[model samples]
Every structure is written in structure tokens, then in C-alpha cells.
Target: MDIDVNDSTPPAPEEYPDVDGEPPAWAEDRTPLGDAIPWFRKFQGGMHTKEGILYGLLISGDAGVRSYIDDEIIITRTGGSSERDAEGKLSQVADQKDDTAISRSVNNSMKFNIAVGVVIGKKNKILKRKLPHAFNVMDYFRVAYVWHERIDGFIAVRFRLEKLELEEKSWWAEKGSPAPPRTARRKWVKPIEHICGACAQTYYRIYMQGWMCLNTSCSQFWKLPDGNDPPVELDYDPKWLDWRHDPSDEVQPHYSLVPDFMSVIDDSDPNSTYSRTSWKNGIVCPSCKQCLSRRFWDGWRCDESCGFKRVLNMQTISLRAVVDDYEVAPIRRAIVFDPGPKETALIEPEIDDVYSHPYRRLVFDLPGAGTVTHFVTNREINAKPNGPNDLFIQLQQANLGLRRYPLSQAGMPYGFVVAVDSLPFSEACDPILRVMGRLTWATHEATDKQGVTALIPNELLALGYFEDMAINYHDDGEDTLGPTIASLSLGAMAHKSLRMKYKYYNGFTKGSKKLVHDDPVLEGCANRDWRLDLKQKLDNNELDWPAYEAEWWRTYKANKSGAAREAPPCIKTQLHHGDLVVMHGDGVQKYYEHQVELEKGGGAKLRYALTARHVLPAKIEPGQWPKGQFQLTKDQDYKGT
Candidate 1:
């Protein structure tokens, strides 16, 4: 079949604008209604508040709920949680109860003289028009009317909202069906006001048939004076629907449609005077004008695919300046050597006169786990050429292609960059390899009592942290990974802590609610009295090891309803510049997890962590192996001193 390739080829698909891949031309010049205002949770229902002030309201057109929307007016039903019976099945005929706090807040907005931003959900069938975005911002609105109404035998609170700027043209108006002229005023009619004899609550005669006490709390609620049943079919008074709101000059919102990003300190500024918290808020893209959350470690990027990205230029800071700024406190050694069964304190090793090394070696042993060795580097390594200071500068200048990675199932990227197997042992990575070699040697000496072989690292993970960035508690436990893991710290000082994993931390069972297990469990935590009592029983020979374990489980199951508590850190220490840390034994990874956080206060603006690990070759796919080999040159290798 000798057919011409050009003849057989299909013509290029008709090109319309790539709506998802590219921003429209008008996106840069015109501001989007949704982006101009602060919408914290755009997709959620109910009201949105900022700084304890109600600022926005989200209305969705749910079934059996009446929510009408036009150009200038919107009549919406209040949100309520679904009621369920004793059998856990949803109730059919019961009235949905509104959150008491939310109802009170919404009712009091008028009294507080607050104007709320209105955003309409696309599910609103009353809109009768498709919207360009998932949600359409209909400008600021003031609550014109609020009253309790009975719908389908259930009491529901209804709100009537009028556009604040009545003269302005509505953004949702279409050419085929234009919005009614704002200048045309509706005839105003005052509804007859009634005072309930039982509750003394003032209500309006909204229905043409009759008036009744609408207050749910009153004994005469929804009851007529004649003691007759109210009509199931009700008709609203035409006059009440035609009520008009007079323009008011009092209602003013605290936030503006377009937030002023230029007024604040520029994030790209070289000076380190500003706190990282200042730039943590959402940023408005200069190219697309769309607001984006701070998702990247280096800087901000337009998620709308506007091809706009701003990478922050970080400068290496002096360690002396950082120490001065932090008011360097004296390092504290572990006070409790042994935790004595009941306590969860880390057992610090005694620094006896053994092997005399240049750096101070501090080893912390974890019972039933492994050991954590901390090699506190001397002044020579901290200040020498091609040392921590130089290495920090080299990392800053090198293009390591570091970025935050999505390590969890949720797909949300981390706050800090985790560049794994990207930089080999060469040039910028030479110092890391040198430190890893020293750590391997130190690990062998430290774990001599345990008789564990020191594993030489074949893989490296370089992590970069900006101000306010941190790595949360997680284990590097993988089937392919060897027993030993080592890391070298550079630039800013950090606090590294290792803790034992709690059994009920993730969950007691599948789909069960996870227990709160954060550090510093002062109150609402499961008391340690049970453990102390059990330990006493064992010490008195009342129970053996197996019996003791069985009794512990029995007590744990019995007190399962008690608040969950996290185990305190077994080893807590500071990792200064040029410091090397190592963890030996697979049990360490299985039973414990570690976290690293940058020291607070106006300290160094940047930090780098290079961790080395050994990956079993047989576990990896043959085709997925990394290209090129890394070798530690003789000069680059470090042997103790």
C-alpha cells in the first residue's frame, strides 16, 4: 500500500481557544469577579468569614429548597444539616435544623450594619443561565428581608438580598434575555405587621390567606387565632414581593474587590527583614490577575496556565548574623538518661573517655528500635574553605532543579523541596558525599555494641527550605532501603526530633476516626496511670512479659474511648551547620519517625539538607535505573578527622 503520507494524514483539528491550557486575552486586562474578592473556600457552602467578621455568602439551589436569583435581587433559603433517625437513616418528613450559631450570625448581620459579598453556585436552576465559572460573584448585597417560612411542612429561614449598587449593570446579563432596567423602580408596599400574643415576636403578614406565629420556639408557632389548621397551599402577597429597598450610604465592606498587592513588601526583595509569613498569603498573578495559593516552595505560579511564575532569589546568609539574630541560647543536654518504664524520655549515652575524635559524638539509644548518632562538627569544619559555608553558597548557585514533590495520596505538594537522586556525588554534591562517608564511619563505631554493619549510601535526597518551611513527621521506611540512613546539614540551623510511633495515630481500624497525636499532650490525652499501674504489677512479679503485654492490650481496649495521646520525642537535638546525623537499624525506621523544622525568629533565610541512603539494586526495575554513576574521589572522602 504505497499511499502518500500527506494524503492519508488528517487535517489539523479546528483551533478554538484552548480554554483550559491558556488564559483568555481579556484575562489580563479585565478582573475576574471571583478572583477580585477573598474567597477562602470557594467550593464550600454557607457563609465565609475573615477575622471573625462575616464577609461572604454562598447559595446553592438544592432540591426542595426555593432559591430564586435575578439581576438585582436574590431570595435564598438558609443552610441546614440533614436530620437522621436512630437507625442512621436520613429522615424524610422531618424539618432540617439550621446550625444555631450560623442562624444567629446571619440574622444579626443587619443589626451589625454589615454588607456581605454574594457568590451564586452554578447548580442554581433559578438562574436559568450557564455561567463561565463554577461560581459567579454577583457583587455585594445587603439583607433586605429575613423571615421564617413553612415549606413542604418544614420550617425554613428565608433571606431576601438586594444588590448594593442598584445602578450598576449586572455581569450575568445575556444579550438574548437582558436584565430589567435598574432605573425602573418596583412599587413599594408595606406588609401588615403582627405581634404574637404568646412570644411577643413581631412578624409580617406575608401570606394572603392569613397570618400566624412563625417563631419556632413559641407555643403558638404556625397556629392561627381560630385554632384551625393552616392551608397546605400558600400564596405570597404580591405587594410583599414588590417591596423596594431605598439606597443607603451606611453599608460599607471592609475588603475591596481587587486586593492591593503592591502596597506590601515585595517578596522578591533581597533584604531578609520581612517575615516569611508576609508572603504566605494568596498572590494575585500579574499576567492573568487570578489569585493563586502559595503552592510552590521557590515562589508563586499561576495555576490558570497563564505562563506566569515568580521564582524567589534566595541569598546565602552569614551564620554569625543568624546566631546573633536568634540570641543563640546555650545548648541543653538530656537531663533524664533513663525513662524508667513509665516516662518516655530519650536515653542519652554517657560521653566517657573512649575514642578521641575531632567532633563531639552524641548517641541516643532507643529501646527495641535502634540508635541515633549526632556528630557535632568542630569550628574547623564550620569555617574552613569548602566547608558548610562554601557548600551553602555552592548549593545556592547550582541548578539542582529542586521543587516541592507530592509524596502523599492527597496529591498536595509539600512545603519544602525533596530533590531525590537528582544531584550525584560531584561538584555541588562533593561536600555531602564527604559528610556521608564520615557519618558511615561514625555509625559503625556508634553501633559496635549492636553489631550492625554500616551501609554506604548509594542515593542522596537534597532538600531545600525557605523561611517558615518544614518537613513534617514521616518515616523513610521502604522495602528497598537499607538499615542505615545519614544526612548532612548546611546553612540555617534546624531542630531535628525523633519520636516513637503511636499505634492509634493513623487509626484504630480501617475507616475509623484518627486519634489526635500531636506533641505536648498536656490535656485531653490518655493518662499514663494505666501504664504505671501495669509496670508496678510487672515489677512485683504479678505478671510475666507475655502476660504483661496481654494486660496492656486489655487495658488499651478498655480505655479506647479515652483521648489519644502522642508519645513524646525520644531524641530532640539541634542540627547546627556542618552537623551530621545518622540512624541505624531497620527497627529505627519501623518504630520511629523524624521531623525537621527551621529555628524560629529572624534567623537565616535559607537551609539545605542532603540525606544519603542505600537502595537495594534487586528491588528496583531494571529499566528504571538511574543513568550515570557517582563515585567518591579519594580527596573528597572523609575518614574521621
Candidate 2:
């Protein structure tokens, strides 16, 4: 359960914001909330636990946040195994009846920071009376509200470097000139005509336009345009479309947990809360200096990564182990780290600020360092022993390198504890493991314009096959999203529902037809409750979307700006190993209202293709924004949408 610092009083249903069970019809047009972006920017070593937040707002002029003496948070660095004061100066320690306290680090360096920035541990439920950061530091207490976790624990850096960056006043956004449009596309040459000498029998103009047989029966009857012998173009419009191609075998489900987000409900607090936000989101415009975005949990964020990223921490609740007797892996880690790159100037977004803009911006803009601290607490229910080791086994079972792991590493080398923000590979991950392979190989090597190698000879055949079956429909518009298109399974597979998606924007109002409450928006559509609403956001144009839903996107403005608050989606999930499921693109319930029904006990972890046709403009730098990754929010400084 989550505890909201804004409201001191613990809330019940009466105090809770009235959450509706349904959304409007036009909600379909809203973009699916940008998927979460993992946090791996930090160069965090091993550590757990976070202190209170100390915030200082950025005012005008030459004035700035003071150092530890003045405007700074004034944290006292007191370190020790059992010492609680700044400098770890405690002399004596008390014994506990049971294991009341965690095993403190014995190494002098492992001692906790003695200086006191602000103590925001769960012990004291708030970043209150502290430096006054934008967000409620206490929010990290509940598992529901923590950031993504790494397997053993979270990957976090020390506070010293983080403090250094804070004092540097380097908190700024980035800017860039848009790239020239990709023009000069290939001219779609037309097909040619061929005439027989005597019988005048026609034959396909294969020599001129290749064998695009318009009519199978008249294979040799090649049609002509006006008087042009070999037309550069041929009939391909919907009006003149024909032909069929066989598709490959259906790809199975590759489920993935919307990282950093374990569940909707916050079980820590009595409120039984739900965190609507996640880490697997997109890259925003030149925001933080660090181009921090990653997969899997890395220890620390890049130096330039934002400081006040809300890190949610929690352990997975194994359904199989209802009682404490069963072992439960309290943690399965996945982090979103910062990757330093675009830290020059402020580049504001060009779209409207929706949902809660000012608050989100402040929360996002807070200049500090990012960290991922993770630990486990055994809260045995009914006084039972939850299998810790066994629980850990379940957690790592589906990881990429699960097979190459050690259960009890008494003296084994720690596996590569990579920060997802860094490149994702064992020395070879960064460049080789890219969504788009090298644009070009070495000088001696060969590749296509797009950097494709000749080794994949089967690619041509696969493309032709997919295109053919894509349009080849025989059933009576059967109204089902069957013949599932290609699905790319990364690892943990799960979410495969026959749904469709149609995004809308700024289309929410009391009685708008698109806002119709809780009814099916489209004919034959099932599970239409996932519809989203962006009535608050201003439209963004930095990245010209290849396509849009309903073409109804309108200019918008920030209703307000304060603290960023994300309401978790009811459908977000984490995938398990060896799981496979299938869903079609047409009925995907992309934008419009949609419902998701689990197949009894068969509901496995959730999955997303991460294969949305999101294309970046040319201006995006290769070194900065990794391939297959983009931002959901507008940049840092733009004024209008």
C-alpha cells in the first residue's frame, strides 16, 4: 500500500479519488502511455537504502543552491556500522532481542554516510523538514512506489559523486537542429507493356518491370499505359491490388514485465494503493544532461542523469506461496539508468503539457544524481519462513543469462552487473546488440545502404512473404485480429490478446461521444477498457509521427505544473520464462476503449512488442539515442506544441 505524503491522513475509499471503472470512446485516440524507460544511468556500486530528499527550487538570476554550508541540503556525512550520526561517530551499540536491525557494513568504507543530508528512511515517513525536494521522498518506502530493482539488489552509486554533481549547477536541458527530411526517395517505376507480332497475344513485360503478374490466367498478357512501351509504374493502388503471399509460422509470445513496476496496488500502506507510473517509458527531448535510458537494472546512473527520479522498490508476491513456508524471491531487478550525452542547454518541448505538467517537470528537472538501492525484508505472514533461496530461484528463472548464474556464489566471480543504461552486453552488448545492426561494417566488409549485411540472404524472401499474407484476406471481413503479424519476442513472453489500438489526443470532455462511458467503442471489439486519455497534454511535433489516430490531435497547453504523478495502468505486466502468447494488430485495442480478460489461471506475465512503428527523425544522434528507443515527452525547453 502507498502512503501519500501530500495527505497526512491515511485515506480510505471515502478519501480516495473516485476511480472510474471505464473510460470514454474517443480515449482510443490517446497514445498508449509511453512505455516505461529503465534507469541505468548511474555508476552505482553496491548499496541499499536511501536517505531523505533535500530540495531547493531554482530561482532567478546569479543566485543558486548553496553548498553544504548555505543553500545546499546541509546533509551531515556521519558513517559507521551501527553509528547513526554524521561521520559514523557512535561509540556504543545495543543488542536486539531478535534480528531487528539489518547487517550493517563492517568495512570502513561501507559505513553509512555520517553527514546528514536528510533522513528519509521508512522509519520516518516523509522527506519532511528536509531540503524540500519536489517529490515526497517517503514514497519510495512501499514496494509499489520503488524504482526498478536489479536481481541481488538495486545498482546505486555513492552519495558523494551525486552530491558533487548537485553542487556543480549543471542541471540543464539540451537543444538540437532538426535534420533535413529524407527526400529523394526512389521513383516507383511503372510496369511495361509487350505486344506479340502476329497473334497479338500479350505477354507479361517481365523484362521491363519484373514479373508482377496482374492476371495469373494471362501470364503473358502485359498491359500497357497510353503509348509507353515499358511503363515505369504499374497498378498497385487499392483499386488495382491483387496477388497473395504465404506468411511464416506465427511467432510465440515473449512476455516482459513493464520494468520497475511490479503491480498496480501498493501493499505497504493501508490504502492499498496503485502506482500508475513505470520506468520503461520513452526518451524525452534534451531534458537531463544524461541521455539516461536503459533495460535491465544497472547499479548507477550516468553522471548527467536526473537526480530526483522516483525509484520504486518492492518484492514480487509469488502466488504459489500463499503461506510464508514457501520461499519467495522478494526481488527481481530491472533498473532505468541515466546515460550521459545531451547535457548542454535547455530544449523545451513543442507540445502541450497534460496530466500534471508543472509537477512532473519539477520532479523531472530536480538536479541531483540517480541511484537504485535495493534490499529485502522478510515479513513472514502467520509466522512462517518464506523460502528466500527458492524464491530467488523463481525470480532469476527467466532472465537472459539465467542458465549462467550461481545459486550460492561462495567464492565465484560476480556475474557482470551491468547498468542497463550502459550498452546491454558482455563487452559486445553496446554496439553489436543494437536493434539496427551496424550501418556499415569495416572497410573490407560489405553491407547495404541501411548497413544490412549480405549474410542474411533469407531477408528478401521473408519480406516478400510477410507483405503477401498481410493483404491476402479471404474470410468475409471476419472481424477478428487473426493471422497475427510478426511478433518479436525478446525474452519473457506473455501478453497475446486479440485486440486493436487507435490513439486519440485532447479528446476528453464531460459528454464527448469519444468520452462515452464504459461502452464498446467499436463493433466486435472485446476488452475495451484500456482506452487512455491525454486531454491534458499539448500536441508535440519535434518527432513527426508517421501516422496518427483519427487525425484529431489538437494544440494543447499545460493545465498546471507541480509534481509528476503517474497512475499505473491496469494492464501493465512482467513476463516469465518460456511463456508464449499471440495477439493480432488490427483488434489490438491500441487507442480506443478496450478490455483485457485473463484466461482463468492461464494469465502469465504481460508482454509488449516494443516494436511500435515509432520512427525518429534524422536529427537524433546515433551515440545519444539508441536504436529502437525514443521519447514519449516533448523536450526540456520548447514553449508551444
TM-score for each of the candidates: 0.70, 0.20
User: What is candidate 1's CA lDDT for residue 581?
Assistant: 82
lDDT (0-100) at residue 294 of candidate 2? 21
lDDT of 1 by residue, 143-239 (tens): 7777775665777777777777767556765434444555556455677788999899988876666778888888887776776656755555555
What does candidate 2's lDDT look like per residue over 525-618, in tens digits? 2222222232112133422233222322231223332222221121222222211112222223333222222222222222112111112223
Model 2 weakest 10-residue run by lDDT: 458-467
**What clash count goes with each model?**
0, 146
The whole-model lDDT of each prediction reads 0.59, 0.21
Candidate 1 similarity to native, TM-score = 0.70
Cα error, residue 292 of model 1, in Å, equals 2.2
Return the clash pairs for model 1, or none: none
- Alpha-carbon lDDT of model 2: 0.21
